[model samples]
Target: MFSLLRSATAFLIATASLAQGYSNPGACSGACWAHDPSIIQRTSDNLYFKFNTGSGIEIATASSLSGPWTLTGYALPSGSKIDLAGNTDLWAPDVHKVGDLYYMYYAVSTSGSQTSAIGLATSSTMDVGSWTDLGATGVASSPSKVYNAIDPNLIAVGSSYYLNFGSFWHDIYQVQMSSDAKTPSGTSVNIEYDATGTHPCEGSYMFYYSGYYYLLWSHGICCGYDTTKPATGDEYKIMMCRSTSATGGFVDQSGVACTSSGGTTLLASHGTTYGPGVFTDSSKGLVLYYHYADTDVGLGDGSYLFGWNVLGWSNGWPTV
Candidate 1:
């Protein structure tokens, strides 16, 4: 009986360990229409701010990660000034703070074209009316260009800053940025790609943890809003790779290079939520903010809600 009790206790502990993962804290309220959300917490007031893709760039604020968020305003009311792409709706904003000012890198493009540009804006405060558009970051695309320049993310390593951006055509690319964080100071390098068919990787976000640079990205089709979903059920899952160096040579758990279409699945569509954005909160630590089509709310009815889960790490990999 003593041996049996010990075995049962061990089994229970193992089951609990395996069950550790992401959990949605609660429902958010007020102006929660968010997609590809990038969040930052203000150091002065401790208020949480979210920047998302929308008409210009949607800004929302809340006292906590889970809360009654209120729509503050748009980053650009007049729209971008990038030739044909300007004045159109912006997509996939990445926000970072340098010194005292906040720098927001946003994408400008037509609905389905490689002719796109990544623009920058800065503000002392993240308030909607305070932003000053700094124009294009010298990352632009023509019809002849192989990589689409959208979904921009900024990472600062030591004193150098690098910008990672790209979509469908060649997956994700990285380039060193000038000190101002606006213009590219070096040639762009292809960091992540998919050899499996149409190359469905985008939204590249790099997080530095425990001496490893974890490159997290969304794979497969996304942004169906309501009417559409990935044809393959497994297409729109969050995938990840890691490396000691931030610039290149990211690999999966099995030692396959990310440039060769290797990635470890982090999160997949379970229940309703899909297409998670890698985020970090002060209290919640690492979080995955995603959009979900509520089944009870029905599909194609335009009810995509924001969902989030605080991530747990095991063996240097994030699980959610």
Candidate 2:
């Protein structure tokens, strides 16, 4: 009995160590399903944080990139209402910090309609309860305008600001914001239209990398589980291209064009991986954060969680 007890204690210690291994970055393997990963790094402490799509804006973060993550908190408060009816299609949530204040951008619309619009909120803290919605923008800031406005993200170049967004109704467009990060400042520039497929390209995430502004988007259908099986092309891949300007005519480095129904694939269904969001890590450089649609955990239905991989540039083109 004494020997058995000692052996059991040893096993428990090993288990604890294994579980705690992810406390160090680059210690774990194969956790790729992060959708629209918006990353923020606190320069003061030199720690990076990830906020992406999951069960009601689920948030899991690690001390560093390679992590055994700890679930910090949801992006939304415990009972916050995204939709009036509480439909909970909390698709893409982008979180970034400006000075001491943190801002979150996200979408709220049910499947199969142009009724969706992207909304914004701000908080000084990471806890979900602190955020306050600034309202939606698409067509005249109308909450019910219904032109499929979602996935609003920010691009700041000095005093000028740009808001990028789009959905099924049309192509992704960007309008300058008034430096204050509030109202529109100029006419909207139409970026990419009807990207490379029947479905309207959505989830437009923009970041400057390698001296060019890259627009990474997910083309093809996403998230419809009314039926037991999802259709082909429902959710599969990610494609990207870049341009010299903040608002493109963005193209791949090879001069391959990124237009409606046509852009280069950064990632496509691989062992379950799908739809990627691009971010430039200060230390890790370029990183692709996305989801794997058919993983066993969510049954491949795009009930997405977070996964990430380091990105590298090869022969002037970006690859995972």
- Reference-based TM-score, model 1: 0.89
Worst lDDT run of 10 residues, candidate 2, spans 1-10
Candidate 1 lDDT over 90-124, as tens digits, reads: 87778778878988888898766888999998988
**Residue 233 accuracy (lDDT) in model 2:** 41
**Which residue runs does candidate 2 get wrong by more than 4 Å?**
1-35, 54-56, 78-89, 137-147, 195-197, 224-234, 253-257, 272-275, 294-298, 301-303
Q: Write the per-residue lDDT of candidate 2 for residues 88-124, one digit (tens) a residue.
A: 5465677766657776767776556566656667778
Q: Which prediction has the highest TM-score against the true structure?
A: 1
Residue 208 in candidate 2, Cα distance off native in Å: 1.2
TM-scores for all candidates: the values are: 0.89, 0.76
